[model samples]
Target chain A: MFDYLRYIRERNFPHIWCSGCGDGIVLKALIRAVDKLGISRDEMVMVSGIGCSSRTPGYVDINTLHTTHGRAIPFATGVKLANPKLHVIVVTGDGDATAIGGNHYIHAARRNIDLTVLLYNNYIYGMTGGQVSPTTPRGKRASTAPFGNQEPAFNISDLAEAAGASFVARGDVYHAQKLEKLIVKAVQKKGFSVVEILSPCPTAYGRRNRMAHPVKMMEWLRDQTVPVAKWERLSPEEREGKVRTGIIVDVDKVEYTETNDKLIESLKADK
Target chain B: MKKKRADNICMMQGNQACARGAMMAGCRFFAGYPITPSSEIAENLALSMPAVGGRFIQMEDEIGAMGAVIGASLTGLKSMTATSGPGFSLKQENIGYAAMAEVPCVVVNVQRGGPSTGMPTFPAQMDVQQARWGSHGDRGVIALSASSAQETFEQTIRAFNLSEKYMMPVILLVDEVVAHSTEKVVLPDPGGIELFNRKQPTESPGEYLPYRETDDGIPVLARFGTGYRYNVTGLCHDETGFPTNNPEKIEKLIRRLTDKIERHRKDITHCHKIMLEDADVAIFAYGSVARSARRAVFLCREAGIKAGLIEPTVLWPFPSDEVLETAEGVKAFVVAEMNLGQMAREVELASKCRVEVHRLNRVDGRLITPQQVVEKVREAL
Candidate 1:
């Protein structure tokens, strides 16, 4: 029998992502978080949109919904609301989370439902070739933006905090252990939670940019971020080029299904 | 099963009957957004679902509502959503996904006038073609149309049953008039209504393959929890329910999906003919338009004209044989509907051009009246 305690699909090896892709690190962090938290695979569901990062669910031994392009959040929301006994988690890529699925992402956070979203921010639309995405840095080269993109990139964790997520954090592939701790914290929260992990895309993203090698991209990711506590101490000039990577929005509020459960209980009591 | 009597007759609006029928079919989850002509369904569901120990969510948009329904259905709960034309158009992508992934859910489209939001309060059968061919890819769809408040109730339950039986999305197509009208309906006893749930995997968790085709071409469904822990995707997949790139595997999957419905054509197509005894003229129609055609058939009989009516309750997997049988020995056909000859073209093609076809179409957010149908029949004559 397949073991539910160990949250890894042992038989399905040789996953689809290319070598040096940061998706593997993020996947390991997610499994470690769930495993460390003693969450049973039977009680967990991993939903993903169509992207390279979305493929993590297949290698994990959990109920997985690989939904259409940019629809993983709504699909995950349905699973959570339908059966509150289950813990729902979502993994999405830059294009899957911010561009096509932006509405569902923001609305899911705004509703403050109990779903932990592990957003793999790989900068480029790696699944469909190196197309420019909503998070692709302005003046960066992509397949679609041959002359460099003109639009500004989205600060995803900040966007999630603004969208009313109860717990918002940023982690990077450079620090896998720290990322796992953040994921564990997010999953333990009772309301909507989001963790944007800065993952590298050596295939689609690295070849086109100046960080053509995997080490160059890894070094770049390591140099760009600071803890949120230290980030606040820096001057605007110092913070201009740095990203604040830590818990950004954490608060206590009644979750969506809990309120709905109360409504049901009141309705039942009236009868 | 107890016999349904007239004393069981209760006054029910079309949408309310639909909601009640959904509850009877074991639908414990409903996710929807408010849209006219189908809003009462959501309203009634929101009020009644919690009382029945089910959950109801008013999603952020039509697309989310559809997506949620698929998700809930993956958990092996009977789930459904109701929408009108504009909303139904938005749901096309996920409905196609449901078809591809073999997800079982029911979609109720109380069709209204549309190219885009043509009418909010008026009736039209404009989405009949869209219901049949709206989604991308070669997909299987079971779309049922009901004419009255009573049929809308029974057919909705049937829609859920068929959706589970076929493991695909079933569309219950209604119009603004049928969805809004009220009439006395004899509610079926809980024991009398037939409910068909999806076939679950008999094998234990580790040995289960979600999409492994059975002898009947349907796979056993393993719900989201319960340790099955399988993957469900929209891409053309192998028997293991994972995306496949092999051309041969894709061809087999598509052929099986297509033939699963096409091979069961008789069981899926529900149709009826009225006053067709030795008839030479046939009025072919469905949905609310069938009511006008029925009246026109009666009026023609009083005038000593041998007129008949053929209405197919199941719009998709179009009732070709039923129309061909009704068209036998008939010379002219009058297709009456609330669109620009959408179904008329189907009837014409199904009849094999043995009889000439005429359309009495109305797109001004108005239903085709009995008088209008009679005029069209006379013109065809």
Candidate 2:
């Protein structure tokens, strides 16, 4: 068994998440994936924006940067471009990635920079007391949306694909073991890779919706998602609310830093 | 016999000189969003950086640009970003974050006419106060200004130096006239230029404290991949670089952020003074307006109204003591700038009501002529 303690800052450990919050599950999966890859903690930089999920960096003992709200992708981009040797991973949430940071998200994908982004989609804003988020399902109740959320939810994995991410995948906290595998594959890929994990904000999101208990939220995740292989066999009508949990898009492209390095080399040769 | 100019001397635009200066300062990374009157700095670096094996990224937005600069700086690289008023406003939040986290980076703001998108193509010295107080906080700020292309180049290098020394963001305030103006600059040899880098901890990784206070109150920071696995956040953090709610620790951290700069005001403050001996009227100016003020000084003297000029390259930490001392001998001050009256207020405060201060302000997006400062000086006397 891999020792999770080696990767975590044990001193800062009375973790801030609620009992059933899936942030912990995602954190553990991320650690397991990193440990399996055998990447030294020193070479991995964990950059995060403001959210409960963003707090994951503080617990892990690597070179961590807790940056401003919605700016983690740009920050990670700089880190990667500055020292391509460092493996830059950005941890962000639905609101942090899709709403305030929507432009950066799409642009990073467009550049196809070498970044592995682990975005936690918790349906609602859990940090600032359960506000309606960009990923909040239409007609779901929230603090700001006392009346049901009238806005249509975003399919983030599809958004990444449309934005030109070299690799895009979806996973859920309920499928923790498989989620680790997905993260491993995303980190192993070259250009911009996005792994959107459907995590539960149990205290804030679950309490407002019908699934107040942590187990209930887990069960809901289990019911709403289908394996990619199984989902391909299902008809459009049969796939009503079920999301496919696997790689949605994967293709090869020249990474941004590599392209930039080539340009530098060509200029040197010309001189 | 006449002397020959060095082959390195060339007519370089202010923005291009500034970009070249960054490269000379060992800056390895630049991230910026295009804004009017300041886009050339980014454009020049976009081409020039690749030649030098440096990185230049045009980010999606101003906030992202600021964030990227800070991120690069933490990786132990000298980094910078340039912007105008509207973009500067968008960058304030992360600028504050850099101050709090003690990241060393340079932010260049080319002053333009504005409360909003006031004047893109025109010149104005409106960001003087904003450079000092733009970001929300009690954190210390160091801002430098330049009146010519040559000065802009030199100050760009100094901006990076101060940022690295203090481990905080330094603002390089340039006006549109200076940024776009072309002037002759004899680029210095790399060996002759003085540079500064952030202090790294000598302690082993286990004993390293990224925020541990030294004798100067500035903490040494370790680069990310150098085996120092520490946490850096915008939150109030302790010496170990992890967030803490302890009031004493928070108070110490906040005070040190400012005290580190304040204690070294002598080292950080820079002022350029001209012909004040046997003068009755002194002209206080900075950025491009100082060019007119210098001409006005000679014009005032030709008219037998003895005059001199005080041009501050370092605008913040305001050099109040020097101004206050100069105020004692001069009977009056003529404050010339492109804004309504930003630095004029500072002149008044520095003079402490002892000497009469008159303003020569222009907000019509035109230069304040030498005659205008002569008139303001006459009115002040």
Candidate 3:
């Protein structure tokens, strides 16, 4: 853990996150994935839209951009297209990605651009005082929805898959090691990859519900989601509410940057 | 249409000239949406950008297009985007972001009539005010208006150079008339023209601070891939490029961002003055209306009235010094625009209530004619 100190920006530390926050765990899992991949820090470009998760770029030692709300995907697309050598990572929140930046997300996936997006789904807007997000579970309570959330929650992996992502996975912060492995696979993928990290936001969504404590929320995640094999083995009624955590899809496709590169080459050849 | 290397003295539209000028200025990335009057710029870049080892992408929306251009610019490539009123409105958020981040890029707005999608194919100079105060907050803006195809070509290159020089976004503002009109233009040879690239950091990654200011307010920019890993945020940040809530730091940062351009106002201001030396009545105009103002000056001269024109190519910094200097001698001013007295207010401010300012405004999405300007000047006379 001490050897990986170079990846962290210590000067910016004692981060502004709340106590017992799962955002830190997700950040650590990302750091471990990056370290394990052995990619040079200088070659990485981390970009994010506005939110608590977006602050992750500020605390990482890399070429980073903290952009406007729901804008990280398009910004990362520019970086990836301009310099294909630099690996682009997009860190986003549920509201940032699924609600406001939904167009950029689906288009980025449809184009199969080479970007690894780690979506930290705390099921609520932790920053800006706890509003219900697009991924907040149905009937969950938030500041904006004190009675209960009336909107249906999004299946993030399913959204990405439908949008033509080459790699799509869902992980829980409760299983940090396995989450880190999914991030590594996402990083290694050739085209647009999405890894949904079901992070606990005890300060926002959990407190309003029955799981007021961070431990309780973490335990809920552990009990609710099962392994992919076990999930597949269960009957429809038995598997009703369990969220499966693992890589859902992995395949090869021509990345958007390479397609543009080929076009550039041909245009020059014709010239 | 001529694809030859030694092509010159060829007929071209103003939008095509702007696209060529952008190419001449070493812009390698273009991201734009298809919008009326300005769509030709995107069409030209779509075919030409790839041929020159550049990239052109038709993004999902104007905001995304602006976002992509900024992204490409950060990777050390000169990038640009073109749009009309509706598209331009959508791009304001990112344009403000570019201003706050000090990202060097160009945004070309071919003006049209609009409160919201009002007129698409018609000419209007209504965006003159929006160009400066369109984006939120206090920041310096560089906007150039072109009256002809040749001027649009030259101004596009100037826009890119000014953007690179100041490390901020520059706007090449034209109207439907200027954008769609075709004329014979000679693109300057590349050897004869000088281009400026961004200045890079002297130190390596560990020792570098991306927003460290020099004597001039411009900071040394490090592109994404060259290993000077640093942070860029829309939030008020310090020299280390990290967000800071300190009031002192925020004040200093914003002042420097603006002071860098305001201090260089002399170099930034570019205008054309005709017969204003000994004239009592002067017509203030820009973009397509400037053409009508020139003709009005000709008719006024024919009528033996001492009417001159103050036509500004650079509109944002507003050429306040020149306007004030001209206001000293002029008795009354006739301001002509496609909209109702947007820029005339600035003319009044520069005049300091010394000269009588008359506005000849139009909002029917039609070009303000030379006769109308002549009539307005006659009324002022």
Candidate 4:
């Protein structure tokens, strides 16, 4: 844990994230995961796109890339393919990952490259002052949705599973230790892995909805999420309105780099 | 790997020759998509890269391809990406990032007709302007246009050298005709060729700035995993690689980008000057059209007309000084290209002297033949 603290930029402490904001919690969980893996700090590369969650790379002490909006996955893919020795991680928000950059994210997962994506889903664009995001619940009030958000939110775990990610998991900020454990597992996995952390935006989404304090947001998260194993035991009615937090998908597949290398070798052998 | 002395002669397309050149130049990584005329380059790289312990990746699209090449270059490997006009357009943004980050990489744009997918199978040099201003911001680029398969091989080697020397992207502009047309080429002894690598910083990690300008206006590039802690960004940054909005810093940064090529103009720029000693008629051309103009110049001189050809090998810097000098006493100049009069505008800009510059334009997706150039020169005369 002390070694992991070296990766954090102490100058950026007391981050701009509002009190009880899920982003900080996610960041902490990520750090703990890195520490648990005992990966060399110099061998890590953190890439991010433009958004509140994307700012996570700026606080890390590794080879950090803060790229344009919604382009972090491609950049992370490039970094991984370039040097397979390095551990590449992407920290992106729902808007940055699922909206404009959705194409790249899906294709990257389809290839199943060795990359770990930490998606901080706060249900709104926190940096741009809480505009309705792709994951915002329908009928939720946002700055852009004065009345209520009418668009259907995406379930990221399902999307990752469908896109061929070898490892997919979801955890809320309130479940900090569980999130850390899942992140560690994803980092250790040898193919495309994504850990969706449902974070709270107290200032924007929480305050506006009158669940303004950190304690109330934590209470809501604790009550709204169910464990994945217990999810099947619960009746459909009981699980109807809750987010399931656990490793939803884990399987083995040939990674992109390894497959490409083998294909090239076979072609050369035939020649 | 050490280069061995050999003279292997073969009849191959210009694109194949480029692939051979890249292999000889120690390029171990190639990421590109298949596009008309330029697909042969990618295909050949796919077959040849593995033989030399290299890798080739056909990415999902040109954007990802170019990004992969940039990423590979940062790993201390020579890397390249090949594409045509539309694919080239998709690659421009990342090319700009490579430039701003001082990454050494090569981009080959085998030219084709296009506003959007104009001619897939046909030939055109319409991307001359895009090669200069395709990306968003102002940055220096080194572009070389090859006239034949032999030059294609030679220029590809030079492209790698320039990319490494300047820590910037070097464009190899080959029109569709030259790219696909077969010609007998004599392979040079690789042992005799010169290769350049990007200069590494001598300063300590804390003292180094990724974008710091040297006396020659070129910055030193440190490969990733070198413990150089220097930041790389697309934004306007100071020498230390930190973002800065200072007007003076921005001005100096842009100036360095421009001046690095401009200040070394004499040494970097290359062009062919023929029969300009006392010639009254000149034909300015490049790539396939330049080859046609060379033959036309011979025909014109035989007909008692003092005609000459100026073929620009370095396209981006425009070879302005040579163009101006070569056009000094000429009564008329004919600019022939496989495009809608792109380089003709540059010739007009350089040759400020009132020489009647007639353009022999061709956008019909075919090469501008020697006879057509001869006729245009005769008409201008």
Candidate 5:
């Protein structure tokens, strides 16, 4: 437990996250996952894009890059390939991953580039003062969505699965230990793995609505998520307003870098 | 120059020659996406790099390709990527980051016709301006153009040297025709060629600033594992590599980025002045078009027209002084390229005389022939 604390920058603590912001909880989960994996600090590269959740990398004491608004995946992929020994984890937000960087995220997944993407899906663009993001709920009220958001929220896990990601999981920050376990599985996965942690932005998404505190937000998450196995078992009324949580998909596939190296080697030998 | 080794001579396309040049220059990593005219580069690298103890990755896209090159470069490897027009446009942001962060890498733009996806399989030198100013802000660039397969090999080597020396990205401006066209190239042995690795700071990690300039205006870079914990950013940064809003620091940072190349103007600029000694007319060209211009100059000289050929190898920093010096005695300057008057504008800016600068351009996915260039030269005369 204390070892995990050493991986965190206490100076950056009491982070800009609000009192009830679930980003801090998600950060703890990531730290715990890294601790469990026992990967050396120097051998890990953490990349983040611009967002409330993206700030997770700054608080973590690792080889971290705070990149442009939507380029964390490419940066992380670079770090991974440059030194195949380094375990790369990209901490991105819903808006950061699925909006401007949507192309990169899908492509990275499609290549199955042995990266672990921890996407914090807060369902709104919480960093730029609560704009309507690609993952903003269709009728959610955000600063830019005064008349309620018209765009349907992205099912990011589904997108990742479709994009050939080997491992895909979703968990709510309200379920801290569960989120941590899923992250560990993601980190250990051979190919591209994504763990979408549905965290809460109390200051942005919460204050705008009635869920004003961490407790209320946790209650909302608890009410909203249904376990994947039990999803089909639920009645229509019971399934109402629930998002599926838990590992939605896991399949074996050859990773991008390794496959490319093999192909290059064979081609050279033939020549 | 030393005697060429047996392995140096290979009948290959210009793109393949580039790969061989990179290998000779000690480029250990290549990350690129397959785009037309540029695919041969990736194919050659993918086939040859690994055997030479290098690594090649076909990244998700050009954006990822650029990022991978920079990342690999940070680990103390010479790295490069090849792409065409649209992919080049996609890579602008990371290219800007590499510029501001002072990362040494090479970007090879095998030019293709495009406003957007115009001719994927055809040739155009449309990216000349984009190569200089495609990125968001003000920073100087090192660009090289090659007219033949042999020159492609030589210029690619020079691109790596400049990238490492200046700690900036070097652009190899190749076009579709040159990239895909095959020719016999004589590659020099590794021992005979001069390769440049970035100057690492001798100071202690704490005392070092990654972006800090020495008196000569080039920053010293330390590889990532060397325990030098310096920040690299796309934002305007100070000497310590930290983002700063200080007006003076911003001014100095921008000036140093540009001046590092400009101050070494004589050393960085390279061009071939053919038959300019007593010529009354000069034709300025670069890349494959220069090859055609060479033929044109030969025909003009036979016809009793004193036509010279000025082939600029260093396309950026624009060879302004050299162009001005060469244009002194000429009555007219005919700038021939495969695009709409890109290099012609530079010739006009450099010449002190009221010289008539004419442009012979081709955007029809075809090469500007020697006959066309000769006609332009005769008309200008």
Candidate 6:
């Protein structure tokens, strides 16, 4: 049994997440994954932006930076480049990662920088009172979309894969144990890795989407999500609404900081 | 860090001087986007940073560049970013974050004409008020301006020193004239200059408080990944650096964040009072316009007018005391700037109706000439 409580800031107790918010669950799985790797707490740095999931850094005891909205990835990029030895992790949400920050997200992947992005796809902007987000399913209800969201939703994992991330995976809060394992692999990958967690925002998202209870949201995850191995076997019609829950892409690439370091060294040698 | 030159005297452009001056000031991280009139600073740093064993990245946009600078600064590096008007607007949110979080860093805005990318390659002293109150919120700021390439070099170093000492972002504003003009500069020996680093906590990690108030009102920021394990946020946070909703705690945090900069205005403000000792008419200016103001002062004196120039290198914390003191002797002030009249309003407030304030305005992407200032002074008289 891992001593997860030791990793949290006890003084910040009574965490900010609502009774059934899935952010807490993602936080726990993240702690367990780091614990499994035997990494020192001091060696970890968590950077987050403004969102319900961005609050994850405040609870855990590590070098955490909660920055402005939609800028966590770039901040984390700086942190990683500043000290390549430290394992930098970015905790963000669907809107925070894909909307305002979409450019940075794609650019970081394109550069193949070493960062583990634990993106919480809650399907709505929960922190700002359940506004429509980039990941909001078409016809989903939101405060800004009371008449139902008119746009198609983004497949976040696919975006990361297309953007050239070295590692990409998806998991749900309902499968807590499996999610922890996936996070471990994403963190181990050398270049821009993304682990998109299908977390629930019970208060903001679930209530309006016909699953008001946290338990129902978890059940929705269980029923709608299929492992990628299984998902690949299903027909196109059979996979209409089902989400794939496993690694979609994993490959080796030249990490940005390593290349930067080499360039500095080569310049020094020439001098 | 390599010395600027063997003899320490060289002719360099204003942007080159700024980048080299930053190296002397121990800036180890730079992230910026390419914008006209300020792109040379980034281009110079891209070559210099790698040579000096520092880091540089051309970010995707202005906001991300500002964000990266803050993050790099938190990790105990003196980080900076340079941009122009449009980019400066995009960086305002993160600049506000640096203020609220008390992260020490530098932002250089090479003044270009703008309400919106109005003129990229030309100079304007338009961002004076914006530098002071650009970021939305009630927070005090420190901004410095330079009249020449040499002064831009020295002021860039001073900007970093003040930022580190005060634990906040310092804005270094240079106009397009100073940024692009080639001038002779005697670079100071790196060892001969003074530099200030952010205060490090002497206390153990267990006893450390990231936002604990000190005698000077500045809080010590522990570098990230150095066993401090502390949290930093833009939300109103208490001494522990965690967000709080208690009205009293929130108020205290806000006041402390602001008072740390406001209380030390004397040390942060820098200005040049040229020939103001005995003058009936004083010209108030800064940036490249200050060069023209100095010439106008000399021209006024030759023509039997007791005229002087009050050039504020530090534009914010607004030099009101200096203005008030100078206003006692001068009959009136001729405010010259490339903008319509930004600093003129500040001068009027500082003078407190003791002297009439006259304006010499220009916005056609041209530097205000000495003749224009002389005419304005004569007309006011």
Compare the candidates by DockQ and give the number of the best one. Answer: 2
What alpha-carbon RMSD in Å does predicted model 1 have with respect to the real structure? Answer: 2.8
**Model 2, span B76-175: residue lDDT tens:** 8899999999999999999999999989999999989998999999999898898888888788889999999999899999999999999999999999
- Which stretches of candidate 5 lie above 4 Å from their native place? A1-20, A210-215, A226-233, A246-253, A258-271, B1-7, B201-208, B352-354
Share of native C-alpha contacts between chains A and B (below 8 angstroms) recovered by candidate 6: 0.81
Q: Tens digits of per-residue lDDT for model 5 on A1-271?
A: 3465687766555677877788888888888889989887767777777888887776776666667778888777766776677788888999999998898899988889899999999888887788888887788889999888887778899999999999999998889999999999999998999999999888788877678787898899999998899997998898877889999889999997787667667867876
How does each model score on TM-score?
A: 0.97, 0.98, 0.98, 0.92, 0.90, 0.98
Candidate 1: pairs in clash: none
Q: In candidate 3, which residue pairs get closer than 3 Å at backbone N, Cα or C atoms, i.e. clash?
A: none
lDDT of 4 by residue, B1-381 (tens): 988755588999999999999988888889898898799999999878876557787777788788778777876789999999999999998888888877889999998898899999888899998999999888887899999999999999999998998889999999888888899989878888898877888988768777776788888867666666544566787886655679999899987888888888887799888887778888999998888999999998998888898898999988888888877778988999887788889999999856878999988887788899888888988
Error of 1 at B265 (Å): 1.4
User: Candidate 5 docking: what grade?
Assistant: acceptable
Candidate 3 docks at the CAPRI level of high
Q: Clashing residue pairs, candidate 2?
A: none
- At residue B327, give the lDDT of candidate 4: 74
- Candidate 6 residues lying further than 4 Å off, grouped into runs, are B1-6
Tell me the DockQ of each model, to 2 decimals. Answer: 0.76, 0.87, 0.83, 0.40, 0.37, 0.86
- Tens-place lDDT per residue, model 2, A167-245, is 9999999999999999999999999999999999878888889999999999999999998899999999999988999
lDDT per residue for candidate 1 within A1-271, as digits (tens), equals 4244366776667788888899998887787788788988888999999899998888888888999889999999889888888999999988998999999999999999999999999999998899999999999999999999999999888888898899999999998889999999999999999999999998899899988789999998999989999998999999987888878888997799899899899988999
**Could you give candidate 1's per-residue lDDT for residues B1-381 as a string of tens digits?**
987657667999999999999999999999999999899999999989999789899988999999999999997689999999999999999999999898999999998888897898999989998998898888767999999999999999999999999999999999999989999899878998889988877788988998886888887878888888788888888988787889999999999888899988988998878987677789988988899899999998888888898898999989989888777768789999899999999998899998999888899987788889888888888
Error of 4 at A83 (Å): 2.4
